[model samples]
Target: MDGQPTADVVDQVKDIPIYRTSVERGHFPILEKPEIADGFPDNWMTPRLAAALAAGEAEFVLSTGTNHARMQIIRPPYFLLNSYYKLWSEHPDISATWEAGCQRVSLTTVLATEHVARVNAKKRGGEPEAVPPLDDRRLDARTLYLNLRLDPALWERDDVVRMLAEIRTAQQAHPRGWYHLDCSGYHLAHLVQKARAWGLWEDFPQPASIIHAYEYTPLNVRRHLREHFTCPVVDLFGSTELGYLYYSDRHGHYRPYLDEMSVELVPVAPGSRIHSLIVSSVRNPYMPLIRYRSGDCARTLDGSPDPEKISRFCGREKELLATPHGPVAQADLDDRIADASPRVFLHQLHVTAGEAVLHHTTFDGEPLDPRACAVLERELRGLTGLRSRIEHREHIPVGKSGKYAWLVQDR
Candidate 1:
């Protein structure tokens, strides 16, 4: 790692077994999950790390594996949570709300909700309850988890009523009747649509600030959120292993939050606008990953490798699709679909041997007009160089991870 500007990191890890070879060779290759797991804690054990563990200042935890395989990692207690709070308190658009003692209500995945319930149950020496108490779902003094179903589309009236009642309770707890909303953009959208349909929208408390940080949010979904909410709709791009790296402002432009970290963008292929995200972060003291491939991809404002110029955290590099024109990213296709019609909501591209089919559902439960469908087909054909068609459905299902997959290939 010679010539790397992060000299402090080099000094810190130069003696660690996993990084010794790279340090000696003056070249650090991208660190993969398997390599980190092969040796485990023994490879990373140093006097400082051992002492931290002994003092209960650090502990081992597993990544959520939302986008990839789960992996064990070490960090201080509540490391990721503190990082999020710091950003929220400092963000220009939402700082006032954060300082005003606004409580947070998270609505994302059933996996997350279940994880919390199970942990609380274990602490209480009891079996996991199907409907845990509200205090059990509270992560801390301020944050609460609210979703209990894998698919928001399957949320019955009772489910919606319970969640809205919780939101009302949270709102009442605040002196100003304001609370912050943290959610998966898709999940929040489904909740809004269902609340309106069931005449329960009046019961739902309006949020002072909204953040969708769970996964990749489609363009049309974001637009839908803006149409329904008057507050800021921000997107945070990061992972469980790495704390937040970038966040969008109220205007939807990304700004870097690399405090003790640096990033390098390597093209997925020659002559491609999409680049793989290789991160070197010392944010987690127990494990400082060097040149870690985060499995994510992005594009720059002017197609440069400069990290500050990053415009979009498109999608996972593994999800990029090959095309005659070049590689196409999720954002690449989303831009076209949004242009064809803003009504298009959740969409997945199913590519087979000779043709590509777009399966989609709309916010209003209706298919696109004939002209809009034709325009979408033409745009997709030009982008992928394949026969393309649109198939509208009333509903689309989420994956086991409680997130949607934008691409599915049968070839």
Candidate 2:
């Protein structure tokens, strides 16, 4: 089909009330989350969708809200999981692992683990246990969830021991004693640091393949994982509403996996390099989103609004910091920090009174050298056109959603 909305896309959404005005006008506006949630399932429900729900083909779910407020969405049962498996089984770099029947062990936010446990508990008609059993945390026969804490940096000795044990169990269950690791990059880095410190690294099983799909991983965190694991450490970029869109190969180059979906990039501002991601996807049969603004932003290879040229999934549109130079994305600041010091782990930029202050923590819990701090300050000034200072911190807390906010204004 052509890049524009196809006849099938028009037919799929024409009956929905949210699209009726656009359908009649022959022009679809950028659909935002608020519009999508105003009437929700009722506005989206057509006879076909209604039948799908009744027949158990469609199910209701909430977005993970890592970047913004959680929104309700409908899709085919196990839609996201199926999308992940499709990528894993077909990815050129990791397909061999999938074919070998390597089980997946997920280590991410406690919220995710709790969500799975609660779902399993509901299926069994009981309250969610305080600490879910191994069986309860298993997403399927091939996948298991592990971390039960919000902030990985705050993980105690007991937490690290439990998660490492789970990983070992998952690895041993496979005939080849190999498992695919799925995690947020930060979480895995913290685990490695803690495991080594506690003298438990030897007991931890090395994964056959690693995918950090949960959030926008920092450059330093990626390097830390690479230093530890010999396996492919890939990053999968997409949202809860939309399954895996683009994935990084072993060499850290992103490749699109847009099947039955299309993307359009609109520049965030007049002269900004960052572009907002708008998606037209029919992948979810129950709810086809047309020209939906995904609240995510990216940068292209040549600063053009070409989706195929998207080089980096930079940051959330809502979190972008406006500057005299232009709009600064999380990845923009992260690139400078990573260049100045490889030790920089988690960082947040706070803009106040026309000055920018960067609070950061190092991987080894040591402060940056005076020279490195000077370099970072100069770089920040150049990027933001404001006086800048670097403050080394012992820790930076994660957000309520178990994610880090890179941009903080007046705080």
Best by TM-score: 2
Write candidate 2's Cα lDDT for 23-128 as tens digits.
Answer: 9988788889999899887889899999999998999999998888889999998899999999999999898999999999998998999988988998999999
- Which residue window of length 10 is worst by lDDT in model 2? 1-10
Candidate 2 Cα outliers beyond 4 Å, as residue runs: 1-3
Error of 1 at 305 (Å): 0.7
Tens-place lDDT digits, model 1, residues 1-411: 222536678887886788988888877888888898988988888889899999989988888887678899989888888989999999989988899999999999989888788877877899888877788898888999999889999999999999999998888989999999999999999999999999988888899999999998989999999988899989998887888999999889999999888999988899998989889988897899888989899999999888889999899888999999889999999999999999998899999979999999998899999999999999989988999989998888999999999999998
Give the Cα-based TM-score of candidate 2 against the true structure: 0.97
